[model samples]
Target: MKTSYVSNLAIQTAMRMTIQQNQMDLLKATQEQTTGRHYDVGLTLGATASRSLNLQREIDRLNSMKSTNSVVTQRLSGSQGALETMAKAAEKVRDTLVTYKGNDAASQLKIQKTEILGALQTFTAAANTSFNGEFLFSGINTDAKPLADYTATSAAKTAFDAAFTAFKTANSITSDDQITVTQMQDFIKNTVEPMFTGTGWDANWSDASSQNMTSRISASEVIESSTNANTNGFRMFAMASVITAELMDKNVTPEVRAAIGVEALQYVEQGIAGLNAERSQLGISESRVKKANTSIDAQLKLVNTHVADLEGIDPIETSTRINTLKVQLETSYTLTSRLQQMSLLNFL
Candidate 1:
């Protein structure tokens, strides 16, 4: 048997190295115990570590999509609210028109004009509503206000005045009372009607785009998230309101006023229908978003569960390992202290 003498220095160095290693193990075990996840997933799971990483990435992607969906839902809700306000205002005007159509009593006609003007103002306000600094009815041009105010000095009012002046000059009518029903009808058909359609409408009335805002509610599903003032309904609403408000106070015959009422009432009805259609489409999108969120929630739960299964650790096992490492580290420290005291000088 070969006899070898072990030096105290050698034992101390070995014990110090063991203590450092135990400390590292204890730290890792404590972390694993607290998080219930592996400290070194690559070493523990080997080639399958990539699977856990992929699942976590999927979770992140889903979370990002959910965040986006939240914005989409907010925009949709705001759009719906504005549309509701517009629809209600339009409905009120429609009721007024139906109740007083062809009733040319001076006081009654004045009341009707006042109500129509007020409704028009309400419609414009709602159409220009903004959310989060974006105009709700501006379609994809969210930064721009959708509708121009039809005030006395506005371009729309100027254009209408010019159109009416041209009509009167063409018809050789010097006075407002000289405008007969036939002349008025001709003016509306040839001049007023065209102003609210196509380029004329764009130039004078609306700053909104025809293409509405679209949002991706899910990976595979996208939907229109907004409407604009360029729609037929909005055009009709402005047309009816403007024509009645501008012409009702003119010194025209009751026959002519009654004729104007007939045409405006028809336009108001059409406008109401158009607004209803827009509301219906938006409602459908809202329902779809709700369903998409439900699906996303389900996907998130499934992906997170998979990630946990792949990276999870046994808490009991990790805790036991932590305690064992702590004891080993303490023993090493004690041994190192004792070894330091056992020098040849001390023995002497």
Candidate 2:
């Protein structure tokens, strides 16, 4: 009797263990069928597991880059458009100066001044553009505005107005005649350049951070995200705006206004050239970003193919496996249920 009882216990234990294994197999097969990937792909693929993992990781990285590149692309497109508009505005100013070589008529001067003011405002607004709360042109200083409102009583205006007045005063001291290119050169070197220097001017010549935004476009490549606002082109625009801003200043003598008008005709050409050069640079960077994105997407498609080959399972085969396991598990349960109760009479 004792021996029979011990044998019965052993049989029950083995049967239950088999049932547990069948349950695990059923769950695993079901999971594989649902996901269409091998449950133990690493073990199934063996030596190729490393390659699959690498491919998967590469795909993940590419996806991340694709996301960031989209944002950068938007910023570059907007930047290009804004810069192009500024260039046209500066060109219009040059054209106007060419045509209106005479006096500062209220209506015509108003039109020219309006155009320059529009360009200046556009430049500043573009400089302060933010995407995802990041200032696109502020370099590494993503949180700061790169330019101040030119009309405000702000430090930028104050510094510029003071410098222009000083230039006029210094020239007045030197000669009572018309403004000369030589005097303009001196004013630019001594007065303008110094004000733009670090310590002399309180207002930021440019509040843009010095560090350029960058991104890894590929496994082996990095690219700049956008252009900074501190270029010589920006300086030229500011200078043109300053000269144009004094169009209606009642304090200046007609000779001084005519002298400024004369200087403007020559200076605006340089501003247009500066804008074009910078635009070319931005165009180059934009081309590279687009090219890199194309390469990234192509590589991602190929890598994804490699990953699917290594880790993917056939849906039909997975479904069959799942069904077979379920049947086997049910059979085991039925067999367990049918086991006769142990009794002394049966043993006898």
Candidate 3:
């Protein structure tokens, strides 16, 4: 039989290693208890760690979508407000035209012209409204102003002058009042009307895209998120306002004035209808976004519950293990102390 004697140094070293291991276990158990989660998820989950990883990725994705949805909702709300402002301005001008139709009284017609011009200015401002540093009515061209200002120096004003000058030259008329009701209607139909369509609008009035903006509100759903100034409603509003403001002060008879008022009112009504339709379409998209968020929230709750179950630690069991580790550390320390005292020199 071979006998080997173990030195106190070796015994103390082994006890110290055990104490160190117990302290580490105690720290891990305490963390698990406080966090209510696994401290070493990969180790504990082992083969199923991939499942936890995938679920966490899903949570991140859903959270990102939710954040994006919040921005989309703000944009939609801003668009709705701009449309509402435009609609109200149109309605105010329409009412003024209706009330003062055929009056031809300089004061009343002047007031009516002022009202129409104001509405046009309001509409233009609304059309060019911006939200979050982007134009609300610019469609995909959000970085640029949607509608050109109808100022004296603006392209829209220059185009209108050219169109009207051509109309006067074509009819061989020297003055606005010399123009008959039939001639005025012809000018509007053939000249002013055409300017609001095709390349004319794009070149002179609108910088917006005919194609509106679309957004993904959910994983599988996408919808039109914004409307553009190039829509018929916006075009009609500009047309009616320009005609009323520029032609109302003409030295024409009440009959001609009435004819112009009638034409403008018709255009204003059409513009109102167009704006209402845009609002309706945007409202639908807003509703869909809200519903998508609700669904996402539901999915988040379910995914979080599964994640909790997968990575959760039992507080009671972790606390018990912590206590056991503490007791073992204390015992190791006591044994180490005894070993330190058990030197052969103490016996001598």
Number of the top TM-score candidate: 3
Candidate 2 TM-score over all chains jointly: 0.75
Tens digits of lDDT, candidate 3, 1-348? 998976878778888899889988888998899889999999999999999999999999999999999999999999999999999999998988888877877898789888888888899888888988999888899898999888889888898888888888988999777989999888888888888866789999888887888888889999999999989899888888999998888888777888888899899899999999999999999999999999999999999999999999888888889889988988988998898999778989
**Candidate 1 vs candidate 2, TM-score winner:** 1
Ranking by TM-score: 3, 1, 2
Q: Report the Cα RMSD per candidate.
A: 3.1, 4.8, 3.0
Model 2 regions lying over 4 Å from their true place: 1-19, 46-48, 88-103, 107-115, 171-204, 209-211, 247-259, 333-348
| TM-score, cand. 1 vs. native | 0.88
Model 2 Cα shift for residue 304 (angstroms): 2.9
Candidate 3: Cα lDDT at 39: 94
Between candidates 1 and 3, the lDDT winner:
3
Considering TM-score, which of the candidate structures 1 and 3 is the better prediction for this target?
3
TM-score of each: 0.88, 0.75, 0.90
Q: Write the per-residue lDDT of candidate 1 for residues 277-334, one digit (tens) a residue.
A: 9989989999998899999999999998887898998888888888888888888888
Off by over 4 Å in 1: 1-7, 98-112, 336-348
